[model samples]
Target chain A: MFAFYTIYKGYFRTALIVQFQYRVAMLIWLLGGIIEPLMYLVVWRTVSEQQGGSVGGFDTNDFVVYFIAVMLVSHATFTWIMWEYIYRIRMGLFSVMLLKPIHPIHSDIADNIGYKFLTLTVMAPVTLLLAWFFDASWRPAPWTLAAFVPVLILAFLMRFYWEWSLAMVAFWTMRIDAMNQAYIVVGLFFSGRLAPLSLFPEIVQRAADILPFRWMLSFPVELLLGRITPRELLIGIGAQLFWLLAGYLFMQLIYRAGIKRYAAFGA
Target chain B: MYYFRLFATYVRVGILGELEYRANFWINIIQSALDLCVALGGIAVVFSHTDTLGGWRQEELLALIGVYFLIGGLIRTLIRPSMIQFMEDVRQGTLDFKLTKPADSQVLVSIQRIEIWRLVDVLISLPVLGIAFLRLGASLGPIESAVFAVTLLSGALIIYSFWLMLSTCAFWFVKVENIQVIFMSMWPAGRWPVNIYPTWLRAVLTFLVPVAFATTVPASAVSGRITGATLIGTVALAAAMLLVSRWFWRVGIRFYSGASA
Candidate 1:
């Protein structure tokens, strides 16, 4: 544990400096992230306004707040391991990571955290400006705010581990872009990125509940929005915990299998 | 004829190169289907709540989605993949090989690399477009069809010039690949009518990114939402942009040689 901590520390420090060096690229990435939720915000806001100030119980201001919260939460839980793995495998860069004594995920996790740390500085101001622009009116109870932290962390872990396992598909097929894209499309809908869960069709919402995506993104946003009841919050957290463990185990299984394949064929 | 022959040669070469990777063919189909789903799903949800969004009826919006996939297919089929290769060539200083080629460097770079399977998006979108038209119970009169063809041509020209201009920036700016990526990042906005966006955002989508012309204008022509003035403006813009990008390409080539000189 001590050695792992030290390795992560070194990785975090180095990745932070590298991330800062490519600050312009980071800004472009940040722009893409901001645009998604902002697009939904506009669409739903239009819907709400056209429907006489409310659609599916969310007024224009409610939508503004919901989407803004979603932007932050989605940003917090976002994982790029899919693209990262695909590129690394294609470029033969993963061999370096494979040879390292430690598991590669630690460095990826460290890099992801480092990136979020840098971008959150910009995200805060962007969110504030958006809230101001759209007249956001959302105030969670103090308890809701307190509960949000653990839920967000759980969501992040669940997303990272599952996606990291998905990334391991590159070991079997160097071109997993199609698989990755399908996963992304699923997440885009099921995770409430396109719209809030309440607004979706009944069957679709039921599928989202069964899938892990809702637990990863929408649950935290709903929790913070005070839209989730206590029973639902308990159930969501339980589902998140379940997925988190499942993803971790899946990652371990895939890692072992992938590494065997890698050693047999060589990266 | 020369350019067409060159493009044909490149297409044959690209197909031969990818023949071993049959998995790519199936993967591309899945990816294209997934793209259509997200687009259609978003429209489904939006229309479920309201009859019209920004005066675009349900079928019209569905047609917009079809056009989105169609244009996105054209982009991926040639422009994006080639530009990516061009960007990498610039980064690795391998663009010299293209510069030395006797053919026009612009045409050579644009057709050098092709992902033949990405054209599935256009194929898939045809049925979607047909269904949308059927649902609307609208037949495209010959004039409207002509206008659509012209607008789509203009749209394609505009995007080609826009992308080429952006790619040319790599001549001076080594890190302009991410700048190229910014186009795709903003592309989802074109999945809907740009009129739904706020004024400033609408302007950005229209003037800055040209998403309006690239996807919506062509669809609008088909849906009869396009006025004569907009069609003229689009053609005029496409022509101007094509010339400007060609001029900029020459300037960049000169700048590239001068710097090394």
Candidate 2:
């Protein structure tokens, strides 16, 4: 454990400096993240107003707060490992990664955390600015705020593990774009990125409850919005814990098999 | 006519090169199909909540999405790939080879690379527009068709010029690829009508990026929602932008010193 901690520290420091050098690229990517949710916020807000200030139990202010929460939570939990892995494998960069004593995922996790740390400096202020601009009004209870920390962390882990596992598909075939797009389209609807889960049709709502995507993103946002009950919170956290473990185990299985195939190629 | 033949040759070469990879055609079809699903799904979800969004009906919005993909296909197929190649050339000094050629460097750079598979987006958009038109029961008169054709052409030229100006900035800045990302990041906003955005964002989409002209204005023209003033403004902006971008490209070329130099 102590050795792992030291390794993480070194990786984090390197990642921080490397990411800082490409801060402009990072900020430009963040612009996409910010704009998508903001567009949804505006769209739903328009829908709510046109329907006389409320649609499906969400007022315009509720839509504003909901989507703002979405922007933050989605940003927090998102991972680019799948795409990065494709690039690495295609460029033969993974050969070097495999030579390292440590697992490659550790560096990716460290890099992700380092990037989020640097960008949060910008994201925090932008969040506040958007809140004020959109007239966001959501007052979570103290308990809700306290629970959000652990839930958010679990969401991040669940997303990272699942995406990292999905990245292993690159080992089998380099043509992962279609698979990635399908994943995104599914997540867009199921994770409540397109709209609130509550606003979805009954069948979609059921599917979301069964899928892990909701637990990764929309659950944390919903919890923070004070829209979730204590019972629902307990159930949701249980689902998150389940998916987190599942994703981790699946990642381990895929990595071992993928590494075997990768090594066979003599790369 | 000489330039046209050169363009055709570049396109023919691109097509022949891509034809070597036959599986990529299927992959492109799948990607385009998924993209269409996402666009149509977003409209479906939004219309589920209300009858209209920002005064756009479901079918009209579908038409807008169709145009979004159509323009997006054109960019990916020609403008984006060529400009990205240009940036890479500038960075690696490979641009020296193109500059040494007797042809106009701008024309050569602009039509140099094509991802023919990306044209799948253009083909897929037709069915979407057809469905939208069928649902709207809209008949296009000669004038309406003429206006749309003009606006669409103007929109494409405006976008091509905008991309040229953007890519030309790499002459001074070595790592301006991120600038391309900024354009792409803003591109999706055009998937919807710009008027729904707050005033400031609307302005940015209009003037700074001009994605509105590329998407919403053309859609509006076809839908019979465009005003005369907006039509004239789009054409004027396209003409002005083309001239400015041409001048900017010349200036950028003057500033570019090869990496070996």
Candidate 3:
């Protein structure tokens, strides 16, 4: 455990320095992340206006809060591992990664968290500015606010593990863009990034619950906004735990199998 | 006339080069289809909540989306790929070879690379536009079609110029590739009616990135929603931008020192 801790410290430090050096590149990437939710917020707000200031159960203010919460939560949990793995395999970088004594997943997790820690300084202010600009209003219970911390941590880990597992597809085929895109499209609908899952059709909402995407992204956002009921919160957390464990085991299984099949093509 | 022939030669070469990778055609189709789904699905979700979005009927927004892909495909197929290549060349100090060529460097760089498979987006957009026109029952008179053709030409020019200017910054900044992400992020805003956005954002989409000219103004022309002033303004802007970007390219070329030297 102590050795693992030291290894993570080194990895995290390297990630922080590397990412900070590329902070300009990092901020430019954030433009897309920020705009997606902002565009949806504006569109939905426009819809609510044309519908006489409310659509379904969400008022304009509620829509604003919901999407702002989405921005924060998505920034917290999103991963680029699926794409990174393909690039790594193609460049033969995975060979070096495999030679390391530690599991490659630990370095990825450390890198992701390090980058997020740096970007959160920018994202937090931007989110607050957006909320203020839009005049967002939401009142979560103190308990839900407290619960958000643990739920968010679980959401991040679950999403990371699942995406890491999805990245394992790189071992089987280098043509992973289509597969990654398909997963993204499915997740966009089910994870409530495109819109609130509640706003989706009943069938879609049901499917979202059955899929892991909801548990990965939207569940925490909903909880933070006081949108989820107490009973639903219990169920949501339970599902997150289930997906988290499943993702870890699936990632382990795939990594072991993929390493066996892996060949150092460019190396 | 010489430049036009040169452009044709580049197009032919680009097409033949891409034909080597035939399987990418299917992959392109799948990616385009998925992108279309996301766009159309977003429209479906929005319209599911309300009949009209900021006075844009479902079919009108569909038309807007059709233009989005049509223009977006053109960029990806020609302008974006070429500019991205230009940037990579700058980073690797390989741009010196292109500069030493006899032709105008800007023209050469702008038309050099093409991913022809991205035309799948263009093909997908045609059926979408047809369906939108069919549902709206809008017959295109000669005037409207002429206006559309003109505006479409101008929009493409404007976008090409914008990309050239953006890419030219690579002469000074070695890592300006990510700057393209800024335009890409703003590009999707065109998937919606620009007027529906807040005033400041609309200004940014119009005067700043000029994505409004690329997608919205042309869609407006076809939909019969365009004012005469917007039409005149768009053409004027396109002409002005071409000159400005040309001047900027010259300036950038002069500043560029070959790294190999």
lDDT of 3 by residue, B1-88 (tens): 9999998898899889989988889999999999999999999999999998888889989888998999999999999999999999
True contacts kept of each: 0.72, 0.83, 0.77
Please write out the lDDT profile of model 2 over residues A179-248, one tens digit for every residue.
9988998899899998998888999999999999999989999998898899999999999999999999
Task: Summarize candidate 1's per-residue lDDT along A8-103 as a digit string, tens digits.
Answer: 889999999999998988988888889889999999999889999999988888889888988999999898998888677767787888789888
Q: What lDDT does model 3 reach?
A: 0.90
Question: Candidate 2's residue-wise lDDT over B1-261, tens digit each?
Answer: 999999999999999999998799998999889888878888888899899999999988998998999999999999999999999999999999999998999999999999998999999888887887777675555676688889999999999999999899999987788888999999988999998999989999999999999999988887788999999999999999999999999999999889867
User: Per-residue CA lDDT of candidate 1, range B102-182, in tens?
Assistant: 999988998898888888999988998888777766656777779988998999899899999999998898768887778
lDDT of each: 0.89, 0.91, 0.90
Pairs of colliding residues, candidate 3? none
Q: What is the TM-score of chain A alone in each candidate?
A: 0.95, 0.97, 0.97
What does the i-RMS of model 1 come to? Answer: 0.9
Q: In model 3 chain B, which range of ten residues has the least summed lDDT? A: B136-145
List model 3 lDDT by residue over A110-157, tens digit each: 999999999998998998888778888778899999989999999999
Q: Which CAPRI quality tier does the interface of model 3 achieve?
A: high
Give the best candidate by lDDT: 2
Which regions of candidate 3 are displaced past 4 Å? Answer: none
Backbone clash total, candidate 1: 0
List ranges where model 2 is wrong by over 4 Å. A264-267
- RMSD values for the candidates in order, in angstroms, are 2.2, 1.5, 1.5
List chain B TM-scores, each candidate: 0.96, 0.97, 0.95
